[model samples]
Target: MQHIRALSAAKETRLTISVITFDLDNTLWDVEPPLIKAEYAQQQWLLQHRPGAVDAFDHEALLAFKTSVWRRHPALAHHVSDMRTQMLYELQIAGGYSEEESRSGAKEAFEAFLVERHKVVLYEDALDVLKRLAQRYILGALTNGNADIYKTDAAEYFEFAFSAESIGTSKPHPAMFKAALQKTGMTAKQIIHVGDDPDHDVQGARDIGMHTVWVNAQRKPWPSGNKPDREIVNLRQLPEAINHIADAR
Candidate 1:
């Protein structure tokens, strides 16, 4: 294992953090803008190709349909991409298309959504912070969403990336963190997981004994009495937070 030694400020003893795992969406970038754009893109596809469906279903209706689809197929709940595609397929069928046509149309509409979805805007300084952090610690990503870092500019900095789609489960389930630990051959204490979500990211990693850094850009109060080991409002504060956690060890 590669270790970077730093003198603990509190204990004045050597400490090391070997790996840093991250949550992609809302952590590295603002996810809402692109998601809105992606939804628009999908709607545009429906308007052009499945006009009746577009006319019948508004945003709220589509959302309801998506929920129905999800409930119908509980086994694939973790697969967001698949769930979306399935919803599109149902929409196409409802639009008076044949089964074969609905299948192909759903696939194409999903492609449209994905193209826009991948066009995410990274938060300012996120790339620079990742670049700096990558130099010292082994960097990896664990995302609950279907966003693929490989398709984004952040791919180069990450040693490995896993999504709930690939792992068959999402964060807060130990499987994601355990997979990272297995992949990096590092113990929970030797890794730090950073993310924006209070439940999935902060509490999830902490549950498994890994250090956590909550990116509370919204300035929300800590939900529970048990708080994260470290907190920051932006990516620029990330390195220092990691150091602070390391120093305390």
Candidate 2:
């Protein structure tokens, strides 16, 4: 524990602390519910709006379609709008709709899906943790999803929010981290990133000199080689981690 404290202290002084950029999806809330709702909404729209075009388009079918499309265009996976459009186009083609009809139905279905996606219920301790952290750190969000953090009512707690759509790059890419640094006017070492993804949040931020906290809510195993500076199973532990980082500074 002393060695851990010393290492934490040494890393803290490398940069002046100010901003803390978080990952929005699984880090803040259980994303599966909203995602499941969105897909369900899309399927209902297809059945009602497109009718005969899709007789058996269900949640499972949509999931398979989404996976297939993402495998084909991994970059598109980061942009919700793009992914929505792609789903509409693919569904239209698969259902044998005419180009014009497909486009029309896709537009309507996508909008319907978007409405359902916003009904996200955050984790129990997310707001409490954010409020506590905000007292000491300038909070922000770094996400790959298309939901506008400002629109989520959590914007007041964040100084600013960023996404792959806004930054022009996704996580695991150094450019996104650089953008966050530039936006906050802080060096790489100044901020600590908390996220659920090992590759995108932990490794990406660590690679760029930022300390990280892995929110292992699911008890996922840490990948070998790349490790986060801190790991916690819940948001209640986040404030202590931030304090540790601040104390080192």
Candidate 3:
């Protein structure tokens, strides 16, 4: 086993960890549930608000539409809010609503979908881990996907939340990490980033000198080419990892 150093009590006190940026989606909650629920809610909205239009559409068709849209506007891939609006518009058009009516219905349905989407249950240990870590480090959220952490009520724990939609840069690009550093006014050495993706979170943070913790919740094999500075299978192990890094310093 690769042993990591532990954070000493004195070092933990003196070492000011300016920020702890997190990846929002899988890192906090199991993404599949909320996403599936959102799609279902969106479909239901289409059936009720714009009936007969979906007679020709199905779940696969809806997904295909979204995929095509993203392929055409890759920049909007991370913009979930914009995507929701577009999806509503597409649903209206497919259902045979007039252009003006489709626009109006989309606005209403999109807002409703967002509310339903936020009813997500996070990992069992998510809040506990964040609460413990927040006592020592400045916590923030850095996500490549556009999820409004601010609306989730979990934003209370994060000092700041950033997304590719807001930053104009995505992970593995290095610029997003730099933006997080700028927001906290801390050097790369002062903060650590924790997330599930090796390329986007681990390698991206490590490339810029920020320590990284890989949250391999699924137990997926670590890809051969990219490796993280630290790896843990559960959120329960995170506090220990941070303490280890702090101890080493």
- Give the winner by lDDT: 1
What would the per-residue lDDT of candidate 3 be over residues 102-148, giving only the tens digit for each residue?
A: 89888877766776677767788888888777666678888877566
**What is the alpha-carbon lDDT of model 2 when measured against the actual structure?**
0.79
Candidate 2 root-mean-square deviation in Å: 6.1
Candidate 2 total steric clashes: 0
RMSD of each: 3.9, 6.1, 5.7
TM-score per model over all chains: 0.92, 0.86, 0.86
Deviating ranges (above 4 Å) for candidate 3: 1-16
Between prediction 1 and prediction 3, which has the larger TM-score? 1
Error of 2 at 34 (Å): 0.9
lDDT of 1: 0.86
Give the candidate order by descending TM-score.
Answer: 1, 3, 2
Model 2 misplacement above 4 A: 1-14, 56-68, 71-77
The C-alpha lDDT values of all candidates are: 0.86, 0.79, 0.76
Across 51-170, the per-residue lDDT of candidate 2 in tens digits comes to: 765565566876787789878887776676887787787778888888888888888888887787777777888888787777667787888886666767576788777888877788
